[model samples]
Target: MKYEADSPEAYIDLLPEDRQEPIRRLRKCILSNLPEGFEETMSYGMIGYVVPHSKYPAGYHCNPELPLPFLNIASQKNFIAFYHSGIYADPELKAWFVEAYRERVPTKLDMGKSCIRFKKPEHIPYELLGALCRKISVSDWIQLYEEKISR
Candidate 1:
């Protein structure tokens, strides 16, 4: 199934009923915690939120019209996936995330390179995840992108 959201907020609205709860939880987590000036929109057939404006000054995308590092919440599939930019921030953060998950990695989850795919909302450690989000600064976020893309 094609993953599509008319607007970032509407993206959550369009999700299958079963997938809505976790997506809501994840969305709430990101919105409440991510730094201000982060713009929200739909990109790459996914719901995306970006720091600063989506176009002006530009982010890493072939087309400036569409936001890069699309953070997706898919209803067709039953899991929450964090797209680029948010993932692979720092090796230490990455290591910290992986290690943290290892302690309670759900058997039902499946993941990609930088995504933590989980079917259930309960599987996520809200405190741990939110703390991680709060911990990183904008400068640190820039460093994350540089390290991730420089390679």
Candidate 2:
């Protein structure tokens, strides 16, 4: 579900009452562990963590007007989606996350290239997500994005 929100607070406000808290918790988890250089904003209609243009003037390769996105979280139609670009770009990181998730969460992981979907909000693994957020710094993401993702 795409919400037209101007800010992260607004995005949370727009979600269903039950979804708000989980999204807020997920947002907090990411914010608390995210590296210093990434900024929080609304991107692709979700709450996004990105390397601001102030840090990388060239901005996102696909669209120079927007900041380079590192992560995003959204309340989707049937689940909560956590999108981490790092896991999609780095094979080692993806493998680590897959293994760690199996060890930490009892349910089967529902994941895509960059999106990790949690069908039950109560089952969302906040600690593992926090650790994932800490795994890559803004500079490290920039380097990886340039090497593996950018055209």
Model 2 steric clash total:
0
TM-score each candidate: 0.75, 0.98
Q: In model 2, which runs have C-alpha deviations exceeding 4 angstroms? A: none
Candidate 1's C-alpha runs over 4 A off are 54-56, 64-71, 76-78, 84-86, 104-109
lDDT of 2: 0.96
lDDT of 1 at 18: 67
Instruction: Say which candidate scores most in lDDT.
Output: 2
1-151 in candidate 2: lDDT tens per residue?
Answer: 9999999999999999999999999999998999999999999999999999998898998899999999999999999999999999999999999999999999999999999999999899999999999999988998999999886
What overall lDDT goes with each candidate model? Answer: 0.60, 0.96
Looking at model 2, report the run of 10 residues with the lowest lDDT sum.
53-62
Q: Give the per-residue lDDT digits (tens) of candidate 1, residues 83-123.
A: 54445555676667667766765554355665766666567
Error of 2 at 149 (Å): 0.7
